[model samples]
Every structure is written in C-alpha cells, then in structure tokens.
Target: MAVTRSLSTLIFDLGNVVITWDPRPALPEQYTGQDAEDLLTRLDFFTRNADHDAGKPFAEWVADLRSSGDAEGADALQHYVDHFDRSLVGLVRGTSQLIDDLKAAGVTLYALTNWSAETFHHAQAAAPALAQFDDILVSGEEGIAKPNPEIYTRALERWDLDVRTTGFLDDSEANIAGAESVGLTTHLFTNAVDARAWARDMTGAAGV
Candidate 1:
C-alpha cells in the first residue's frame, strides 16, 4: 500500500502498544529463591484499576486491597513496596519500531493512557521514545479514564484534534469503542505487529 490519506494526528495507548507488557515473565522473578511459587498465585495483581489510578493514591489502593482479606505473609507494612518492587518490572519494553516509523512520516503522535503519575514517571526511563510524541495524556493526572468520554475528550482537547482526522489504537475493546463514540477512528491492538498493520491500513499508509 502507498501513503494516500492524511491524518491530523495519531494517538496511542502505552501498556501493550509501544511496549512489551507481559507480567508473567517477571512474576516468577518476584518469588524466585523464595518460599512462594509466584506472586500471581498468592496475589491478584493482574490489572490496574481505573478508580484507584484516577486520583486516589497508591497507598489507598494498598489499604483497600489489604482490607479485602489478601493478607501479606511478610511485613504487612511493607506489602505495597514488595508488590511494586516485583511487579513494576512488567512495564519495560523496547522502543517500538512502528512508533518510530510513524514519527518518521511526520505524523503527529500522542500518548493517551490510563496510568498513575508515579508509574508513568518511571516509564519515562523505560520508554524514552514516549517523550518524542507531540503530547502525552495520562488518566491519573487527567482525573479520568477510558472508556469514559471525558478522558478521550481531554486528549482531543489537548491537541485541538479534529475527530474526523484523528485515529486511536488501544488494547481494550471498551477504550476503542469509547474513542469511536467521540468520532475518532479506533484500532483494537492485538500485538505490535497487528497494530502496525492496522495503523497502515487505517491511514492508507504503506508498511515500513
């Protein structure tokens, strides 16, 4: 395919978009050389909750879950730290060639993700290319999350993007629908390869 249609901007989700985000690899390391098999079996640390990520602090999240009967075997006071220590390793992923490719095309790029301020800050080192974007919008700071219409609106608002000329890529169905609800094009990202193909397909831009 050749570059045919032009777009005002391209927005991307962070987790599985430009980064390799699989916590399974790092889970065992969490319990390695320990009595526990892995943290997954002992703790329900699968996904990030939007509410806690919005304005509530991480300490509040730890307290809420701790009160839910998920007792910490070690020092209860240190549970949050331990959890973050082992779990945060899941955030790192190398530079996405697809993003680089898009930037090379002189396309306006932006990061619209539901991430806490601290976590997103740490991500700065993990994914430096993220800074290359024209803009980055995180839900924690925005005080909203997808599929909430507000967050998407906030993104569009930041860029002064025309819904008709913008496209979004995310891993969640709800988020994609939310984007489409607001008049922007959406792609359900299955993997980096799939995302790259769909991006090209959507904008009628040829693959790199």
Candidate 2:
C-alpha cells in the first residue's frame, strides 16, 4: 500500500516500538504468580511510572511510599532503579533495519519517547539504532509526557519540522490520537513487518 503522502520527517516512539522494554525482569523474584499480578495491578506501573517520566524526584517518591508503610513497594521501585538496564530487553525485531531504510531514504528521523531520563542512558550506549535519529525528545528531561499536546508541539518546535509532512509511529492508541490532534500523520505500531510496509507506503521510501 502506498500513501503518496510526501513525508519528510518520521517520528518514532522508543519503548515497545523501536525497543522492547518490560519492568517484569526488574521486579523482585518473590512477587510471582497471582501475587505478582496483584502487585502489578496495585502499583499501576504505567500511571505511576509517568510521574518518573515527568521529572518527579525518584528518591522522594520512594521515600514517601516507604513512609506510608509500603516498604515492599519502595523496594520494588528501588529495584527498578538498580536494574533499569535489564528493563530494556533488547531492540524490537526488525526496527533497526527499518530505521536504516528510512535514513537511507533521506527521511529525517526523530524520537519522542515517554521514558525517564535516568533510564534512557542505557539506550544511548546499547541501542545503536537510536543514533540514526537527528535528535531525541525525552519526557523526563522535558518535564512533560505523551498524550499531552504540549510535548508534541515541543518536538515540532525543537526540530523545526512541519506537522503536515511528518509521520509518527507509536504503540499506544492515546499517544497516536495525541499526535493526530497536533496534525502529525500517525501510525499505530504493532510489529516491524507491518510498520515497515506502512512507512514505505506513507513516506514513499520503498527501496531497501
């Protein structure tokens, strides 16, 4: 499928889109089975974790949880800090190749990720594919996060890119909608195979 959209910029979301990240590996071993599921449910990782991405003081948050008598929760958060690198399992299959293809196609690439600045250091060193991007906008550093219109505007302003010709790829429905609200051509990412095909069609960057 070809879009004939004349895309000049391709914006990518990092976690689960370009790289595989899961906090389960960093969680304590004892929290398993139903208990583990309960812990996850109780913690509300995505919602609570957003605080971290929004530049909240990590130590203060943990201390507050501990002071509230949720020592186990505090320990879990600490475990995340300690084993942060482990959370990034590896690159998402085939995205590195797709990024190379986009670069080879002369499309300017940039990253808009709702990741904590503290944890993103591992990617700068371990994920070579990220190096292909012209620049990366991290929520933690920006003190804002996705599904927020401001961050999208900030990305566009920072890169001096036109929203009409830019394409965005992300796994979250809310984030995709947020990009659409800001006038970015959006793709809801599922896997690299489909993403590559969509990108090729969208950007007219069809060659290997």
Best by lDDT: 2
Expressed as tens digits, the lDDT of each residue in 144-175 for candidate 1 is: 77889888888888788888778888888989
* True lDDT of residue 58, candidate 1: 61
**Residue runs of model 1 more than 4 Å from their true location after superposition:** 1-6, 22-48, 65-95, 204-207
In candidate 1, how many clashes are counted? Answer: 0
Q: By TM-score, how accurate is candidate 1?
A: 0.77
Instruction: Give me the displacement of residue 55 in model 1, in angstroms.
Output: 2.3
Candidate 2: the clashing residue pairs are none
- Residues 94-129 of candidate 2: C-alpha lDDT, one tens digit per residue: 999999989998889999999887888987765899
- Model 2 scores worst on lDDT over the 10 consecutive residues at 1-10
Where does candidate 2 stray beyond 4 Å? 1-3
Backbone N/Cα/C clashes per model? 0, 0
